[model samples]
Target chain A: MNKTGRPQDLPLSNPRADRVRDVAKLAGRPARLKRGHFLVEGPQAVREALKLHQERLAGGEPGVVTEVFASEACLDRYPEFEDLAEGTNARLATDEVLAAMADTVNPQGIIAVCRFVDVSLDTVLDAGPRLIAVLCQVRDPGNAGTVLRAADSAGADAVVLTASSVDIYNPKAVRSTAGSLFHLPVVLGADAAELAAACRARGIGILAADGYGSLNLDALQDENARRRLTGAGPASAFDLGAPTAWLFGNEAQGLSAGELDLADHRVAVPIYGAAESLNLGTAATVCLYASARSQQEPAHGETTHE
Target chain B: MNKTGRPQDLPLSNPRADRVRDVAKLAGRPARLKRGHFLVEGPQAVREALKLHQERLAGGEPGVVTEVFASEACLDRYPEFEDLAEGTNARLATDEVLAAMADTVNPQGIIAVCRFVDVSLDTVLDAGPRLIAVLCQVRDPGNAGTVLRAADSAGADAVVLTASSVDIYNPKAVRSTAGSLFHLPVVLGADAAELAAACRARGIGILAADGYGSLNLDALQDENARRRLTGAGPASAFDLGAPTAWLFGNEAQGLSAGELDLADHRVAVPIYGAAESLNLGTAATVCLYASARSQQEPAHGETTHE
Candidate 1:
């Protein structure tokens, strides 16, 4: 739709063709950064990317998705893909060409080139978010993506990935997100300290999800129970139902003392079994769901005294 | 430890050796079945395998661990591996040979050959399980492995993979378990319908985890709340603390209608966000944790009335 003057006219068949090689280069971080583009593979992610692009275009902004490549079989099965690309860019390629353009061993017949979609930390902060997930130095792509998906599923306003975290544009992470990446704002390269300060300034409580935290999650639940039952209410315990930002740390080292000190509360999801710990992704999901459940519950009136 | 009269005297340096090829072949299902053995890669899995094998050998049963291959560097770093393998078998392998025996890009310096660990359905059922995870037609090896890990972490008694599910011994699944394969009993290739019937006969409540079920998990928690608050309890609503087996389904199709009908109650985890649904592993974690939290709580007196 940008009309850069060159239009593809033929169905690409050669996997080693220059165009295919250039597109395939987007799989790596350096190339993606250099070209200012990333690859979106598979029908689900492509569909979501196109939909978001259309919304941006209608809002008078530059479209994020620049081009789509699909095989004839893929187009035949999902003709709506072609219709979606009418105002943008589209091309037909052979299965081998499409596979070459993809990162997976078995690509499901479609790929898209899109501009980087990360928003600034200020933009995320200025929105006055009610729920957000902050990943500090998360290294695994799948874990990062799953946490993003869990945050999205919990209806978080955004996800902030600190500078040391794995690149969100990593193909494996994108694949693991299962389209949730396009569903919400994912802020990258944020400074953890600055983000914490920003949340504090916004009157948003920060809860650090740490394995060794002194505060047990079930005890919090029990506190909520006693508060509700005895009418000794909210002030007696930290209220998860309030607007909050959850800070999760590196999968291996978890939060440092400095990082833990930055939060309003440090909470641990109780481990009832013998296994050493919950996987990062699973732990984050349980935490997010706890917040979601708590926030959805009807608010109990707070007592003036603690 | 079997003392088959063939003691390995020299370090194995050839990656193309026939013994190495036989070990590598265990990565495939056919070879695993025919040889009645599978490859357990990396130091963590190898450690667990050797420990379990030692336990079996002590109990006068056939050892599960057949052979352990480790680089001298690895054995030097962790002398425990050499000690653990003393009763069984241990061999020095060159880095190249170790890498060839491994399924991962980096095998972390060790690999072990172990017998299949699946127990009979009757064995699992006969134990009068307090908690169990039933996987019905779960096809993704990663998801299956993750669910197994979560089940183990929650202190579930065992994990049963139905007949149509992915092979639990698949190298990818084994890797995803992260050494949890040896943590608890994992029953494979079970019939879902028959398992449900047996669970019923044993007085274990079958709670089918369905995305579209009318009974919301939050509502179940609310019922628990009322039971706790009023003390007029137990018989009116399902008690998660009681003996229960959770039934989960495939990654894509979920549970079929017939599968849903087989359970005593169908439950859904409440989705608070716009994201479609929780992935299989995350959903199972939340469900298992809920039961774990309930069961771990001090028991409440049951009402005699139905």
Candidate 2:
């Protein structure tokens, strides 16, 4: 390959280089917090970080993405990355250097350094959010990331991770989010009780999703059906479309009795099969989409019932 | 710890033992194909294998579980495993031995050797199936496993993996299934075209889920909505509740044009938000649950609309 302009920078051949070591350390929670930055690995995540970074810089806000490192092949495959690197410290590195910096065995030939972009709970609520997903004490990184992606796909306004929840910056969690971390506001380390109180004050009814909840999601849908048949609008019943905050619990042990009590209505995704229950991520997706469908569809139409 | 009964047997301390080597080799495709056996790692998988083994034996079928190995801690944690070992060969091994024979860094102290449990496509279809999940060229083990779990949760009759799909017995996929592998019939390595034909011959409608499909899932729900409002009952339209087979495609390249042509209807899950699309597993879960809710609910009540 012919060497040109920016690609002529010496390839980072040393895995022990200080820059590589610093990026590698960001994989750990302590390192990420201490440095106030996190590593975004793989092509998808790096692309998303750059896209969001450009948006923030355009809005005159501090850029979330500080640096972009790519191999010649990666930059060639995604020429847009070069443009995305315009305002950032973009560097050309050997594949080995990128691997060393990433927590995964393979970093897909690109990685980016991004500052922590978690918004404050006050900021998330001040936007007057209607649909939100609050993960309470969810410890699995993969589950956390999947919920974030699902929430983002469901067009949720925000996602709040309670203090006891898994760190959203965990590389596994970030990888699982599939770049959704950059799509919406994600609040970390918030107190669950205080957040519940805040949501209630803002008129966002909290619905706790648990296996043993008093409200069955099916019954809620039935209520929607009856109301629609009776000529009531989507706003008349407490179905999935209501402005609400869904609180999902831990993987093994679900929301506690006290946690369940914090919600306006405790809801369970109805299980019709022999399988005991849906996993946290799957259940949360179902709940969020239910609400999304309710809120998006017009009253007395093909999509109104559920 | 008291070394009594079978616990007194010497631990298989050698990681390089011939048995350990053979078990470890099963993780690869060639070894599994040649030996007609695969490794089921972790407690959840092993427990499911043994439980299903017991059920098969009771049903007069050959036992699928051939052998089981566990650490003293794992055996003690689940005393039921002791009872489950009645007809199968069980051995106590050191944790290192278990780890060496397993695929993951930690196998949670137990692993089971199981015969390939895939049934013939005809066998799956002959049972008059109402619901099925078909994966076409899906290469990710985790996504494959998750779809199996979701399908099981939704009470599907069976799951069919196209010839190009990932192996269901992959240890990572088995782990992701969370024991759902034993809960339902998983038919692997079937020709996609033939599977579609079999589904058609059985009067099962195939709904292909794609991002750019002509039919919207919400519109399918709307079809159900119009039917219910008009008192046509749940059986009147191309709604989610109809007896159908849901075909999902590869993670990266979705169903090809040729593949999509095989389905009765190409359906797209509505994207209500800005996110590009839902991940394969999450989208499959939503599709499966939609059908489940449709099939399981009474024809005239609260769950009727969805």
Q: Highest TM-score: which candidate?
A: 2
Interface RMSD to the true structure, each candidate: 4.4, 3.2
Candidate 2 per-residue lDDT over residues B178-247, each given as its tens digit: 8888888889888888888877877888999999988777657745655655455445347566678999
For each candidate in the order shown, give its overall lDDT on alpha carbons.
Answer: 0.83, 0.84
Clashing pairs in model 2, backbone N/Cα/C closer than 3 A: A222-B302, A302-B222
Residue A153 of model 1, lDDT score: 82
TM-score value, chain A, candidate 1 = 0.91
lDDT accuracy of residue B175 in candidate 2? 83
Expressed as tens digits, the lDDT of each residue in B54-83 for candidate 1 is 889899998899888888778767777766
Lowest-lDDT window of 10 residues in candidate 1 chain B?
B297-306
Query: A91, model 1: CA deviation in Å?
Result: 3.1
TM-score per candidate, in order? 0.89, 0.90
Error of 2 at B208 (Å): 1.3
Per-prediction count of colliding residue pairs? 1, 2
* DockQ category of candidate 2: acceptable
- Which whole-number lDDT from 0 to 100 does residue B55 have in model 2? 94
- The worst-scoring run of ten residues by lDDT in candidate 2 chain B lies at B297-306
